[model samples]
Target: MSNRVLMKGNEIIGEAAIRAGCKLFFGYPITPSTEIIEYLAKNLPKAGGTVLQAEDEIGAINMCYGAACTGTRVMTASSSPGISLKQEGISYCAAAELPVVLVNVNRTGPGLGGLGPTQSDYFQSTKGGGHGDYRLIVLAPSKAQELYDFTLEAFDLAEKYRNPVLILTDGFLGQMMEPVELKEKPTSPEVDKSWVVDGARGREKRIIASYSLTNEIGEANNLRWEAKFNGIKEKEQRWEEFYADDAEYLLVSYGTTGRISKSVVLNARKKGIKLGLIRPITLWPFPEKAFIPYKNKIKGIVTVELNTGQMIEDVKLAMDCCVPIYLYRRQGGMLPTETEILEFLEKQFKLSTEEV
Candidate 1:
């Protein structure tokens, strides 16, 4: 039976990972994301799991790499700057096709900006954050419930695709509390250890490095990685569409911004504004196909984000700029409030009516 409990987003994610059969977690304490590490440190061992707090983000991610190499479910959590330090390890995990789940509670950054929510890492995440030809299956959760649900789903997706999965969140979501229904715990799947070198018992030596110096070998490796990424795009583009029917304008957003946008859409509906939302759950393997059908029907899209305008670029690309794409954003620590969004929508309606 599912049980409901009020919890913070970071704690929910950590607990959900454990319920998803994740046996190992290694991470460094970072602002707005430290709750995840604290949760795991307190409860993982009681659940027959292991949790390690490394000296730094690099060490934490490498610890995850070692655990994942043994075909065990492993994870790490951090904010933007810490995530930056772990990029090299994330790339290696991707190249090695290891199933590791990473939670990035995004914060403003270029370097150690602050402990405030920011989606500035959109390009870094979707465009391959580290040096290599690979992609991470990135999931963006807007609510505490989604944080729980997506954390479990992330593990499944990571294992299914044999690639790293990233849960991209922001400080607002991490700090907020909400009721979440804990789902049934998943049973651990038997992993094939033929490729893993736990101790190299009676098998050829195993190498998991991404350094193939030969041009031919490197090209072949790239091709293989491309195939895997393509496969993911084909099978794993997840999104949520709300109040789309009879709507002339659509709002596109993710993470905490999406939650606020949902409220805006609801408020606009009361004023008879025809608007809807397309919330991308999987940021990577982006739901490009989802927007194709609505391209001609919708008047335009308003891209809402916490950063200045990162994901807006992706929305424009997905819609092919067929309709006018407007951006509504907040930066640093502040979130785009529902009142601000509704005001923006009212202005859009007036402007569009005048244009017509």
Candidate 2:
């Protein structure tokens, strides 16, 4: 508690990684996320950790894959375009069942868009941007503190599930400075490393590969991966609710958008509007269970985002289309103001803005 300090979200992630026993960082510097590598480069060595700036995102992620096989915690950070470059390596890590932490501080992007903040990478982060039936445990952090806490949690989740875990943030959250409490060191517990390919000096050699030469082996691998994914889905769904117990209209968002929507919910309530919010912290598992309590209560749901519409699909599926869902988005790094969001809700729900 005495360790509280004002810090950028990206730097907080680097600090959290250091405390979590992550000794290796391999990444190329990219805006919105470069601070992560920079912070780690300066501080990680002090913690007896090593930081390497790879020639490219491809090299960086492959480095992560290699380190993960050694049964050690390693991480990489990049923004949208860099993250896209690392997808194949990410898929390889997933297929190899490696435990690695990845950070995507998203910026505007179709391809090299700009340094402006945006949630455009939501699809890529949550929908298996790489190839061939794989899932990354994606966690969305809405604030600077969450960026710190979730980084610690991501390392643990990646190792526990033996898969890649992604901390999906954006340029805004990554660069934003806020006061955050630095939680105590070493939040991770020891895990079994008998599966690692570390050493075979006195025992049988261990091989870690993703290749499947036969259809039978390929299908079996896919089936096993699917079972593991199902287990994650069943156990890891997490969310945060705001004034949602008996609301009629719901706002669903994550990351930066979730932060803004929190205020919109409060303002709407003050004006006597029945508004609530559900912020999904885990994007992969989708937190469908969070909608269960609101299913019979809410009239409609609106998904607010920095992109056109990606998370709305998950929201619709979560409710099974039993409730009317709408979208309010700002593209090309634009952020929707709380007033704009409230206006949209007022019009959509035909609710009064009169103060109670």
Candidate 3:
């Protein structure tokens, strides 16, 4: 019997969260991302869950912060501007070491660009969009299947690290439809919840805080955060490679553009161009390991994006400037085409593009 069912990407995220035992969801309605909350509102109750449409994005994220402290699996969703509003609260969650999942159905933006697709949030997401010296476990899921799989993975990653996890997907993927097989729920490493404030009567008092009484304590707290980030860096960097093992040029991209970049690599191959792709699934732990093998082997690296080269910076950092890197992108929700990418590579790298 075929269990695969067609579903929208945004709704898949909500369904995955529910199956993962998420109890509370809080968010303000925003284009693209609005479908996530909408789906949850209508169906989460069937799983004994509660969905709250807060007054605004700010209220919603803060509500997540409050609920998470009680040892609850909490989440929220929003678009670019709405995510911008949730930044302060997000930073608070990171500092307090709360486990929560967040979804950003990216739209074009510096501010209210449109309900179009854009990966501009790459820099904002991976580089602490929230203030302070903290990092979210950023997962960039490329297609509808990933939108479901990574949402399940996001919750486990959040609880495993006792930190906030962000599922970074653009409007195009969120609004698109695809068939996905609902797999068995994933199992995560047990998190030590001794700090959870779920009635301290059973043990001693638990203070879940992001502050310190003295500067010395504050410095110590900051050091702890740095250590945790370093640990995550060493253990969590993840990426996907398409023919990068043997290629002269590599295309770097993630989310929807990542899937497009794959087609670019295939098309370039048909023309006898030695091209490949490296898609970073974990944007924060930035997948520096993936670039290490291709460092000196490839002539150069090309980054594709729906925004003005935000991820190019990370690609450069990953390659450490040892290998030349280039960027091809379009801003304000414009997606790049396979033809455009091939032309860029031929023009810039002077690669042989013999027509098959």
Off by over 4 Å in 1: 187-192, 349-356
Across 199-270, the per-residue lDDT of candidate 3 in tens digits comes to 868588888888778999899989998999999999999899998878989999998989999999999888
Better of 1 and 2 by TM-score: 2
Model 2: per-residue Cα lDDT at residue 12:
94
Q: Model 3, residue 59: what's the lDDT?
A: 96
Per-residue alpha-carbon lDDT of model 2 for 1-356, expressed as tens digits?
Answer: 48899998899999999988899999998898999999999999999999999999999999999999999899999999999999999999999999999999998979889877788998899899999899999999999889999998888899999999999998889888999999886646778888998789799999999998999999999999999999999999999999888788999999999999999999988888888999999999899999977777779999999888999999999898998899999989888999999999888877766634
Q: What is the lDDT of every predicted structure here?
A: 0.87, 0.92, 0.90
Deviation in angstroms for 149 in model 2? Answer: 0.4
Global lDDT of model 2: 0.92
**How much does candidate 1 score in TM-score?**
0.95
Could you tell which candidate, 2 or 3, scores higher by lDDT?
2
Per-model TM-score versus the true fold: 0.95, 0.98, 0.97
* Model 1 lDDT on a 0 to 1 scale: 0.87
By TM-score: ranked, best first = 2, 3, 1
Q: Clashing residue pairs, candidate 2?
A: none
Best by lDDT: 2
What are the C-alpha RMSDs, in order, of all predicted structures? 2.0, 1.2, 1.3
CA lDDT, candidate 1, residue 37: 88
